[model samples]
Target: MWIAESVTFGGSALDRAAPLRGDAPALADLQARGRIVPLWQGKPLIANGALAWVAPGSPVLAEATAPVFLGLEDGIGWFAQDISAWVPPEAEAVQPGFLDPSLQHHPSLPADHTFTELRAVMAQLSPRHAELAATARALLGWHQSHGFCAACGAASTMVMAGWQRSCPVCGAQHYPRTDPVVIMLVTRGNRLLLGRGTGWPEGMYSCLAGFVEPGETIEAAVRREVFEETGVQVDAVRYLASQPWPFPASLMLGCLAEATSDTITLDPAELEDALWLSREDLVQVRTGLHPCVKPARQGAIAHFLIENWLADRLN
Candidate 1:
């Protein structure tokens, strides 16, 4: 739970500039001060002051760019040019290209200027330095994806300090969307139930999860998804932890469930297979010695939940 705050959207100490959300006068001041930076598709930071990711005159990668307002919600102003007309990410660009040293992306290109995605950059920066970066990255990403009106086909424009979008045609208003998905660590005494999808990397297995439907509750979604995918009945579902997955936007709700039955009748359509394994067996998978099963990646909530569960931290 301690790392929960460090998880996506949990609060990485980003300077959200919340005070400027509505104060028009202040937003204008920042625009004049030129403190704002551009975030590509709401992910990558381009430049601010002397700190820049894209080199001057480098083929303006239009495909990944979006103009975003950075500062408080009261009066944030847009500084970057609108580049939403561009298509998908450039094939040659690294995903989070800012992290690639070969490309020489910098979190603090200029000592006076700051950057976003601080959590990821924190490995090399102070917590305060990383916090501001995280704030900018998450907010910009939200604005980029929510550019279209969900209620109408009209194109929505950024408003409310980059927190709200207004449809041009029908007058519909939209906000950033955060979808909920339940990930369960099902336990039967000393053993844990882990599963693998058909297309997942070989040897990797993790918790079962699914989106919560409009009418169903979080706990019900966990139970229903588990039964539907692997025919394993679960009971005593308990909230454990949660994480934000910004790939398009989703909130992963981690939970613990007690398995009432051990036999796995996998719905092959949903998973390649599933089985109950003891802690000792899991250790092999974690260490890469298990012949058939591999553990989930380190940064994923699935891995975090499992590690904490194994350490009895969820209690």
Candidate 2:
């Protein structure tokens, strides 16, 4: 994995200013002076900005529509609000401040939000910006979806900044969780395997992927998923790369697997079609010649992995 960090959402060595989380006064002072952007779901709950490690008065206390805080891994805090508090069209305008260049507007709720499917804006984001955007989007997404404690079914309160939630009644600590998924490009000699899920539009077939079970390893997950979905037995699953898919908080683990057997027993429930495509057919699909299927999304880890594999750049 020499290019592990080269993958999308790979972290930038930002100085998160960890020591300041506990210093209320210093934190307050810094917030006042940092660059601020208003984030609104239904109502503008909070904003994020860059605070000089020394300044004061980001003045977030008064605008405090809600009390949730977002904690960066390095300890810089992002005070947050449950965007669900706001209604739909309004929630779309959340401005989280200083769009750190990730992918097109960091694919946030703001105008800058980028999506792998939205290619026009994708290039606007610098590689580092895309990484940070993915990170922020992922964190915010987790916060939005996991407001209730899983343990006692109680409404959880934000704690430990925004990095965790605590059950007020039972004291259960719920941290942000990233689901593990394995997406692999299965290959047999010069041919590759791609399949489309039941609801996918026409001819689009990307990689075979599934969630990694609680007891399974990444490699095992890759093999199991390929077999279960298309009856393609895979061996020697080699790790390729990973990415942070914030659609709902998932860590997509990418790999390359060799198909030992390919009979195409299509799982009616899992996929609508499966195929062994030669390099030539793949080119047609990529260029939109193959009318039945669409290509893997750009800016997506699946697309990147496949593109690189085709170009022989994975090494």
Query: Which lDDT values do the candidates have, in the order given?
Result: 0.64, 0.62
Q: Where does model 2 exceed 4 Å of error?
A: 17-19, 35-84, 87-123
Candidate 2 lDDT, 119-141, residue by residue in tens: 22333455544544444555556
- Poorest lDDT segment (10 consecutive residues) of candidate 1: 98-107
In the range 204-312, model 1's lDDT, one tens digit per residue, is: 7889988999999888998999999989898888887787665546788998999898888889889998888898888887888888887776666788888877777
User: Could you estimate the TM-score for every candidate?
Assistant: 0.73, 0.75
The CA root-mean-square deviation of candidate 2, after full C-alpha superposition on the true structure, stands at: 6.7
- After TM-score superposition, what is the CA distance of residue 265 in candidate 2 from its true location, in Å? 0.3
Score residue 271 of candidate 1 by CA lDDT. Answer: 92
Query: What is the alpha-carbon lDDT of model 2 when measured against the actual structure?
Result: 0.62
| Cα displacement (Å) at residue 310, model 2 | 0.8
